[model samples]
Target: MAEWALIFKTAIALFAIVNPIGVIPIFISATDGWPAKDRAHTANTVAITVFIVLTVSALLGESILEFFSISIPSFQVGGGILVMLIAISMMHGKQSTTRQTPEEAQETAERNVIAVVPLSIPLLAGPGAISSMIITAQQSGSFWGHISLALPIAVVCLAIWLALRLSMHIAQRLGTIGINVVTRLMGLILAAMAVEFIAHGISGLFPSLAS
Candidate 1:
């Protein structure tokens, strides 16, 4: 792997998936009722999930996609479509995403494990992130390449964890409106990222379109 290329790709993948800016509101909603101890645990859970998901993708995603005969470009196009749907939902407050679901509030009300399930799983590491990592892993065809990409992936997750830990302090100052503002801003970024993914996949499919 080209060291810089792996770092950049990993960074981009982590940004598009984790979306720390987008997570602000969800973090607020989920941990609103919890004590400090519980909130700390939730943040830790989110970070752990990120690492686990990426590690799995690094080890197994390529084989899984190969078993289905799915090409990386096709997967990227499909993943882009899925991510666009997620971005649209966030912008307008749609229910399919945990970040938007009424069920999320209810779950927060009923349980203490909010971050583990909805927040970390679907909201943070949902279909978009999973597919993105899988496609990336498939593209990383060599052991050295995958290994090189892994550290930056870990660093990104660390940043996300730290960001979530600080959301409480920021939330105190800006409140829900601030969270909403961040989410919307990140939504715009996500939409742009999705478009770029589609464009890359399309370019791969129709190379002569540029000619």
Candidate 2:
């Protein structure tokens, strides 16, 4: 039961951070003029990439940080800032510059395989998501917790694939206004999460300030 609860919380946090529904329009726009089959394939590719990226982050993020002599608290603070920026962008109904710049968008449109670029890297498995996973995994403290985290990550990626595969229908039904509303709600969630991360990191990094 505890493991399941942890998975549920991790899944919700990842889903909120990933915001697949919020990116439906962007996905549609990027795949514009592509055939239906290709779009579906692209969605699959993006989901797989997201799973790989996040799984790698969860498994090896700590080692990577240690290799660079970066502390967990430092990463938490930095990651929080990145997430907060993305959240602010979402609140404004704009894509975060950190996630995808205009140049990257143009390049993604020109590329034959967008699954590895804008769609997967900065779109679905962006820094915020990666950071969130690493921090969450660190908190796990047990082999089961770490192992359990993978399930939710895989499920969230699957959810992203489904949402993208049905982008056309979803877009039509939800419309622009609906999507924007969802974006703002997610932004609010992300903002609160970011603040929590920052505060926790600060307390850990500076024990004197914790009280």
Candidate 3:
């Protein structure tokens, strides 16, 4: 039960950070000229890419950081800052430059194939989402925990797939203002999570100060 709860919380955090609703416009623009079947294929491809990227981050990201002699506390601080920057951008009703710059978005629209580039790579599974997963995996600390984390990662990917598959309807229903509202709310939640990450990192780095 506790494991499932953790998975649920992780899913919520990841979903908020990924915020496919915020990326709908970008996806729409990127797939503008494609037929419906092609658009669906793109959505499926992007979701699969997201799943692979985030699953790898959850399972192996910590080991990679350790291999480079990077400590988790330092990572937390840096990752938190990155997530905060994304949150701030969302608050301003814009996509984070860290994730996908306007130039990248423009370039994405001109690309022949975009599922792997802007959509899945940075837009859906960017630094913020990767960092969040790494931190969550670290907290889990067991084989079962890692397995549990994988479930939520899959759920997040599924949610992304559904959102992209229904992009037109969602965009029309939500409109620009509604999307902005959701973006702002998700940003607020992400900002709070970022602060928590920074706090935990600081406490770990300076135990004496914590006392």
Candidate 4:
């Protein structure tokens, strides 16, 4: 039951951070003027790319931290700050430069193959998302625990794909104001999660505070 609870928490956190609904506008813009088939293909590619990137991060992130001698607590704090920044940006109804800079956005417009580059890499599976997964992976110590993280990752990716697949309909239905409202709501949730991450990290670093 506890494990299932943890998985549910992880899924919610990932969904809030990823915020596929929030990315619908960007997805629409990127695939603008493309054929329906090509657009669908881009959506599929983005989903697959995000799943692979996050899943790999979950498995290898701890080793990478160890290699650099960066403790999980330190990473948690740093990652928490990063996530908080993203949350603030989302609340403002703007995409974070941390996820993709103005240059990348321009490049995305100029490029034809944007599914993996700006869309999946930074736009969806950005540093904040990666860091969150790493932190969760570290907490899940067992092999099965680590592997189970994939389930949520897969679910999130599926959501991403579905959002992108129906991007046009969503954009038309939600409009700008509606989308912004959703983004702000997700941002609020993400901000709370970020606080938790920061608090937990601080407690880990300073055990005395935990008491």
The all-Cα superposition gives candidate 4 an RMSD in Å to the true structure of 1.1
Error of 3 at 165 (Å): 0.8
- After superposing candidate 1, which stretches have Cα over 4 Å from the reference? 91-112, 206-211
TM value for model 4: 0.96
Model 4 misplacement above 4 A: 107-110
Which candidate ranks first by TM-score, i.e. highest? 4
Q: What local lDDT score does residue 153 receive in model 4, on the 0 to 100 scale?
A: 97
The RMSD (Cα, Å) of candidate 1 is 3.3
Top lDDT prediction, candidate number: 4
Candidate 3 yields a Cα-based lDDT of 0.89
Q: Write the per-residue lDDT of candidate 4 for residues 14-44, one digit (tens) a residue.
A: 9989999998988887777899999999999
Candidates in descending TM-score order = 4, 3, 2, 1
lDDT tens digits, residues 1-211, model 3?
8877888888988988999898899889878888999999999999999999999998998999999999999898898899999989989988888987788877776776689998898888999999999988887889779867889988889989999999999999999999999999999888998998888888889999799
Residues 1-211 of candidate 2: C-alpha lDDT, one tens digit per residue: 8778878878987898899998899799888999999998999899999999999899888889999999999998998898899899989998788887788888777776777788898988988999999988877877677777889999999899999999999999999999999989989888998998898889889999977
lDDT of 2: 0.88
Error of 4 at 64 (Å): 0.6
lDDT (Cα, 0-100) at 20 in candidate 3: 86
RMSD of 2: 1.5
Q: What is the TM-score of each predicted model, taking all chains together?
A: 0.79, 0.94, 0.94, 0.96
The true-versus-predicted C-alpha distance at residue 114 of model 2, in Å, is 1.2
Please report how far candidate 3 places residue 211 from its true position, in Å.
2.4
CA displacement after TM-score superposition, residue 82 of candidate 3 (Å): 0.9
Error of 3 at 56 (Å): 0.4
